[model samples]
Target: MKVIAFGASTSSTSINKALATYTAGLVDGAEVKVLNISDYSVPMFSEDLEKEIGQAEGAQAFLRDLADADALVISYAEHNGHYPAAFKNLFDWATRIDREVFKNKPAVYLSTSPGPGGAQSVLAAAVGSAPFFAGNVKASLSVPNFYDVFDLEAGQVKDDAVNAQLKEAVAKLA
Candidate 1:
């Protein structure tokens, strides 16, 4: 399967990015394409901007990437218990181009943070609103206390239990 994976944040050193990419790699025999949401930068969406620019190339390109994917893996980074502005902006623009931005592809949503809450609020929001955006959610996982559970240098999950749970979640796609 061609799995399109991305962290919904623009941070250069986003832990959510690491988690998303690493989790995507767990799918056996799958080709993973990692997307940097920052690369698909669109101006903050607004009716005025929509009228001025018609459509943003970044949003179009972002949609094209999703269109080619057989499945999706998105890890969200939370800011004040909500989506980071960078991600929300691109997402808003993409929605304008195609309300079904996920293209009805099966998806696994994930979130992580340095705290025990694990960014669950945003994950819940994503999962809750997924159907409206045509997201075919297969499963979801939240990895809390990221620095403790994941080994940055090894680029792998260190906790055996979390690793097992992660495997179980990804298995839904197969």
Candidate 2:
């Protein structure tokens, strides 16, 4: 199966991106494509901006990437208990191009943060909103205290229980 994974953040060193990449690797036999949102940048969405610049090639490409995927593994980064501007902007542009931006593909949603809440607010928002855009969410996970639970050197979850839960969640993609 073709799996497209991305972190909903623009940070070059985004922990959510790391988590998405690692989780995508765990899906056995699936061809994975890890996308960086920064690579798909677009001007902040507005009716005026759309009228001035027209559709952006980058946004179209980003939508094409989602359209090509059979499954998705997305990890959300929270900014003040909500989605960062980078992700929100991309979503807005993609939504204009296609209302069902996720294309009804089964997805695994994940979130991690430096704090104990693990970006749960944004994760909840994603789960709640994804289906409206045709995101067939199959499972969701929240890894709290990201630095403590994730091992940067090892590029994996360090906590055994969290790792097991992550594995179980990814397995549902099949």
Candidate 3:
């Protein structure tokens, strides 16, 4: 099976990006393609802009990524209890192309942060809003106190309890 996974961020040193990459490896028997949001940059969504230049190549590429995916994995990085600006911009551009860009693909929704909440607010928001894009909800994993549970240097989960739950979630989605 093929799975398209991304951090929902563009930062080179993003913790959410790390979480997403680690989560992708948990899926059994799938090829995961990680996306770089920088590569899918679109101008701020505005009706004026849309009329001026039509959809940008970045928007089309973003839509194409979703179109080609069988399943998706995303680990959101919350900024003020919402999606990061980079991800929000990409989402806006993609939805401008089509509101249902995800096309009902099964998803392993996730979030992570340095705090204990693990971007729960944003993760919950994604769960609520994702269906509009035809996200077929499969599993959601929130990594709380990420610094304590995850080994950044080793790129693995150090907490056994968290790791076990992660395995269960991945199995359900996979």
Candidate 4:
């Protein structure tokens, strides 16, 4: 499968990105391309910015990525129990260009956090509405207490249970 994966967070050292990448690795014969939203720099979603900038080069490129992708793996970062402002802006910008960037494409929804809640709120928010926006939402997972379950330097999950569940989710999605 041609998988387009991305972390919803724009942080330079995003654990969510690591989780998405790790999940991509679990799929055999899958071609994975991970994206960083910060590189896109979509101007804060406002009609004013849209009219003035007419969409950033990055957003257009992102749309193209979605068009070519067979599947999407998104690991949403929780910002106060919601999507990061940057990712929300990107989603808004994408909708402006293509009402269905997803277009029923299979999606593996995921989230992770250092907190015990493990980005549950953000994942729920996305899974709840992503289908309305053309996502064939697949299995979901949230790694809780991220530091305890994932090793940043290794870029891998530490707990056996977490890894097992994640592997299962990836296999099902693939």
- Write down the lDDT of every candidate, Cα atoms only: 0.93, 0.92, 0.85, 0.87
Candidate 3 CA-lDDT value = 0.85
lDDT of 4 by residue, 124-153 (tens): 999999866888888898888999988888
Q: Model 4: C-alpha RMSD to truth?
A: 1.3
Best by lDDT: 1
Ranking by TM-score: 1, 2, 3, 4
- Model 2: pairs clashing at backbone N, Cα or C within 3 Å: none
At residue 97, candidate 1 shows an lDDT of 90
TM-score of each: 0.98, 0.97, 0.95, 0.94
Q: Which stretches of candidate 4 lie over 4 Å from their true place?
A: none
Query: Cα lDDT of model 2 overall?
Result: 0.92
lDDT of 1 by residue, 109-145 (tens): 9999999999999999999999989999999998999
Question: For each predicted model, how many residue pairs clash, with residues at least 3 apart or on different chains?
Answer: 0, 0, 0, 0
Best by TM-score: 1
Clash-forming residue pairs, model 4:
none
| lDDT tens digits by residue: candidate 3, 24-52 | 78888888888877889788878899899
Q: Per-residue CA lDDT of candidate 2, range 1-174, in tens?
A: 999999999998999999999999889999999999999979889989888888877789999998889999999999999999988998898888888999889899999999899999999999999878998999999889999988988888888898898889989999
Error of 4 at 107 (Å): 1.2
- Please list the residue runs of candidate 1 whose C-alpha ends up more than 4 Å from where it truly belongs after superposition: none
